[model samples]
Target: MATINSSIVIISLPAIFKGIGLNPLEPGNVSYLLWILMGYMLVTAVFVVTFGRLGDIYGRVKIYNIGFIVFTAGSIALALDPYSAGAGAMWLIVWRVVQGVGGAMLFANSTAILTDAFPVNKRGFALGINQVAAIAGSFIGLIVGGLLAVVDWRAVFFVSVPIGIIGTIWSYKSLHEVGTSTKSSVDWPGNITFAVGLTAVLAGITYGIQPYGGMTMGWLNPWVLAAIIGGLALLVVFVMIELRVANPMFNMHLFKIRAFTSGIFAGLLAAIGRGGLQFMLIIWLQGIWLPLHGYSYEDTPLWAGIYLLPITIGFLIAGPLSGALSDRFGARAFATTGLLLNAATFLALLVIPVNFEYWEFALITGLSGIGSGLFSSPNRTAIMNSVPANQRGSASGMAGAALNAGSSLSIGVFFSLMIAGLSSSLPGAMTAGLSQNGVPANIAAQIGQTPPVGSLFAAFLGYNPIESLLGPTGVLGSLSAQNSATLTGQTFFPELLSGPFHDGLVLVFVVAAAMSVIAAVMSITRGSRYVHVEEAVPEKGASVPQPSTRSV
Candidate 1:
């Protein structure tokens, strides 16, 4: 449920915007669109560590139970949004953040709970299933959102209510606190610094992808620069505070474990690569490929999700199998090989043309999914196994933070690269295309100079790009009927966009391939599989046993 909710919003944004009467392409409302897309992730990334620490201090089962109820309430509130336009957008964003809080609680503790329940020998297989579900939920959410949004926008949120309720009751009744809990005061200073710093950084990155002044992106905006720099400074201070705190929200000393540290670094890199690839592929399908192939803009979202099924199938097939294999062969070989496969597939993508065959696209993406599934499950198992039982919650939280933060960061970095690539050649191509289609030369030039971000969003949201761009300027009304019809047709904008979009795709895929190679290198260096041993404690009236570290 946690992972599904995280992704469902991506494919549902168009329907939701229409239902709420908001124009996401408008300059003032772009922030609303960005917030809806990114706020849930930012909040979850910021809070998971703190919540995980809370699980360690209190009880994982107790916190996890509360999460389901909170998540259900947030879903109910989202489905019942009463306003329209900006007000409605705000209402949904706030509740999405609330839902994120619930998700953070669950994400922080779920892996730790599994670790406690399964014996060391069976842990890789168990964690692989759990990890696959979490990763696969993202792809599954895309299809679910597409299908449900066609019927009613509210159905997206409404579908989660029943599931949340059932999960809540089942978790409360069945899950026990099997892991040891430590009694410690909350680390206020550390929590505040970490939350504020990470939130500021991610918000800056989120807004940085939008246009500012005459630039295609907001990187030079004073607010964005301040947020990024100031956030980094605060994080440095946070590290110092953690080193001195009596009970830190995140234990810095966990980095001393080679398996834990190496696994996390590799996971973060792999996550960024995977996240960026997902966005780029969606844009490629919805914006250029599907439209060129006769799909209308309004129908692109659903078809795009349907077409991406091979990637999800690969993930489903490889995830559990890799995990079970890693249990005997160790994580290093499987994880490294997976990342290497990802790198090879990314290189393959770079060579494929924008208008390539569907079978070729599916095969490459499916291999990419197989690679990611192979890496994620074993890496998670390795990290969880390397931590002492008492610190498993905290360790799990760190892993979640790495994945979430990497995803958020990927959007900012990859989007900036694509936009930069587009800005150079897209304006000239668009101006020529429009002028040839009977648009006045001056109007065509004017429209061409406008930021590419608007066009990108138009395509992403399944809006008719030419109509949306030219309608407000009254250019469409001035054009002849034949010209206007041609401009607004499914083929026109996509045909114009293909060359420039492919230019951007090349750069994005190359960078992704490099990141994957680096991740593979890191994965190989994680050394042999190691599990930490916990000391035994007396029964009845004895004090809680302190976990000792002995990794082997």
Candidate 2:
């Protein structure tokens, strides 16, 4: 439920904004869209580490139970939001942040709890199942949100209430402190710096995608620059504090474990690529392909989610199998080969046309999903197995932080790349297309000057870019009936957009592929499989052994 909620709102946003009586694409209201989309992720990234450390100090199951209750309460609050317009949006955003807090608590401790419960030989299979749930939930949320949005907007949030209630009650009744909770002082300074610093950098990246100083992106904005630079400086301070502090919030020594460090890096890279693929695919389908194929703007959101099901299907098939296999075969081959497959799929997506056939699109996406699933379980299992028992909570938190942080980073990186690609050609294309359809040259030029991000977002939110772009200008009302119909027709805008959108899609896919390749390199270079031993170190002359053929 926690992970599903992380992505549910994305597919439900059109209904959500409509229910709230707000026009989200309006310049002033754009932040509402961005905040609602990013707030949950941002809070989760910032608080995961701290909450994991808290789990270590207290008890993993205790904190996890509390997480369920808090999440349920937040869902209820969200469902019951009574305001309209800005107030309504704010209400949801604030509650979403609350949900993020609860989510962080659950994510930070779940892995450690599993590690404690399962034996080493079976840990990969156990963690693989856990990892599958974690990864697949994000994609599943899309389908669930679409189906629920068809019923009512509030159902998206309310759907979680009963599930959370059940989970919370069951967890409290059945779970107790199974892992040792070492008593220790919370590293307050380290916590403060790490949270603040990471938040600043991520928030900066988020804001950086927006327009400022008449440019397509805000990378040069003074505040964006300050936030990013200051955040980095503070992170430096955080590392120093962790090294010097006796009871560090994040154990610096964990990096010394080659399996742990390499796994984290590879996981982070895959997440970055995957997140970009999620958003970009949504835009591609909702904005360009679906509309061209005759789906209405309002219906595009749900269908986009529906169309993305192949990837989820592939993940469901591959995640557990690879995870179980990795236990006896080590992570090197599966982890590396899976990511290489992912890179191949990214390039495949690039090779396909913007308005691609369904089967071709599904095949490529399913392969990508399989790659992700294959990598996720073993990658996570390797990370957990390589860490000591006492540091498992912190290690889990750090890994979660990396995954969430990579997701956050992908938004900024890919959006900027796509926007930059569109900037060079989209304006001219729009101006030409609009002018040819009997719109005045001046009006066409003025509309063309609108930032490309607005169009990208319009398509992203399942709005027809042409209609959304033309609505505010009031020019559609003045045009002749045939001309207005032509301007608003699905195919016309999609045809005009195909050239520019592909230009942008190429750049986005290329970068995503490169990230996957680099990630695979990291995966292959993680040395041999090695689980940490707390009490009994390996004999002085002993070499790392091969993977066991033991069954659970």
Candidate 3:
């Protein structure tokens, strides 16, 4: 339930910007939109390790309950946001960050609690179900956001309120600690450095897609450059500190275990490919394709979610079944093969047209989802199985950090690439299209050159760019009513943008495909199965119990 709610917020965030009457493509507006969408993940990534360490020091269940409360409060605040543009965005951003802290607590401890509750032999099934819920929640958010955007944007946030309340009460009443606990000093220095460094890096990436001065992309912006460079430098220092600290937040030596390292790296890379690709696909459908195909922008979000059901369907079919099978056979073959299949699916997507046939697009996406589901369970189980019970909390946090960080990176990189591609061709195309539609040439040209990122965001938010650009004061103001109406009509702008938009999409898919292939190759290098020697036990009836069989 926590995973579902968290993911719903993630999927719904971009759409919320549009609901609040902001253009997602415009630099100022896009900045706010991006922060609102990525802030939760950013905060969650920064705090998960710290919270995981706390789970080990305090009780996991105790911290997890507090997470539920924080998340619920954030949801209520989001539903009640009273301003627009900057103030409204700040309110959402602050609350979203708080919600992320809650999500981190839940994410950091849920697996630990499950590991304590379930025996080793049955852990795969439990985790698989949990994984399904997480993925399902993301899809559910898209559907809900689309449906509620028509009634009121606030409905999406409110949806979580009742659920959060129920989940908090239920979790408090029923969940308890069955796992071992240990006392350790908090790694305050390590925590602060890690949080600030990651925030700077991610924030830089988020803004790097926005326009700066005359440049369409912010990568050249001095502040953004500093953030990226500074973030990397601090991370280097963080590693050095971890090696010397007694109660290090992150264990540097875990990479010595090949299975653990490979699993984590593969998970991170896959998440980078998947997370960004998901958003790009949603924008393609909701912002451009759906409107061009006859669905109103207002109706696009719900339908886009419905169209994406196939991906979730593929996951539903594969996750539990593969997890169950992995219990008997080692994860090596299944995991490697799954990633290979995933890489192939990415290549297939690269070749497909942006305005693709439904069946073809659905099949390809479903195939990718199946591959992801196949890889996830066994890979996670393998990593967990190879670690000592005492280290699971920290180990799990490390794995999760990789995934979350990869997701943030993917969003930044993919958005930059898409914007770059669109900027190269969209202006000329938009100018021509608008001119041909009876708009004045200068006005059309100016609007076309308004930066492709802004247009993309406008579509993402379900707002028509023509409406925003021509708002009563621009070129449309001097024109006859008939020309203005024709220029700003529902079909005019969507039709004008489709060609260049499709071009941008092709580039996005190619990048995703390459990333997926690299991740697959990395997964293959994990090598044969091995258990942690420290956890191994002597034969039964011997003087000492075997370390591997320490369940009792």
Q: Which candidate number has the best lDDT? A: 2
TM accuracy, model 2 = 0.96
Candidate 2 residue spans exceeding 4 A from truth: 471-474, 536-552
State TM-scores per candidate. Answer: 0.97, 0.96, 0.92
Q: Give the alpha carbon lDDT tens digit for every residue of 1-552 in model 1.
A: 888887788888999999999989887998899889888888888998988899999999888899899899999999999999999999999999999999999999999999999988889999999999888998888889878888899999999999999999999889998988999999999999999999999889878988888888999999999999999999999999999998998899999988899999999999889888878888888888998998876677788889888889999989999998888888999999999999999899888888999999999999988998899999999999898887888999999998888878888988888888889888999899999988889989999998988787776676667887788778888889888889998888888888988888788888988998998888888889888888777898988877655545
lDDT values, one for every candidate: 0.89, 0.89, 0.76
* Candidate 2 steric clashes: 0
lDDT of 3 by residue, 356-381 (tens): 78899899889887987888877776
State how far residue 365 of model 2 sits from its true place (Å): 0.4
For model 3, the superposed segments whose C-alpha errors exceed 4 Å read 1-27, 478-483, 533-552
**Where is model 3 poorest over a 10-residue stretch in terms of lDDT?**
543-552
Alpha-carbon error at 9 in model 1, in Å? 0.8
- Report the C-alpha displacement of residue 57, candidate 2, in angstroms: 1.1
* Residues 164-278 of candidate 2: C-alpha lDDT, one tens digit per residue: 9999999999987778677899999999999999999999998999999888899999999999999999999999999999999999988987888999999999999999999
Ranking by TM-score: 1, 2, 3
lDDT of 3: 0.76
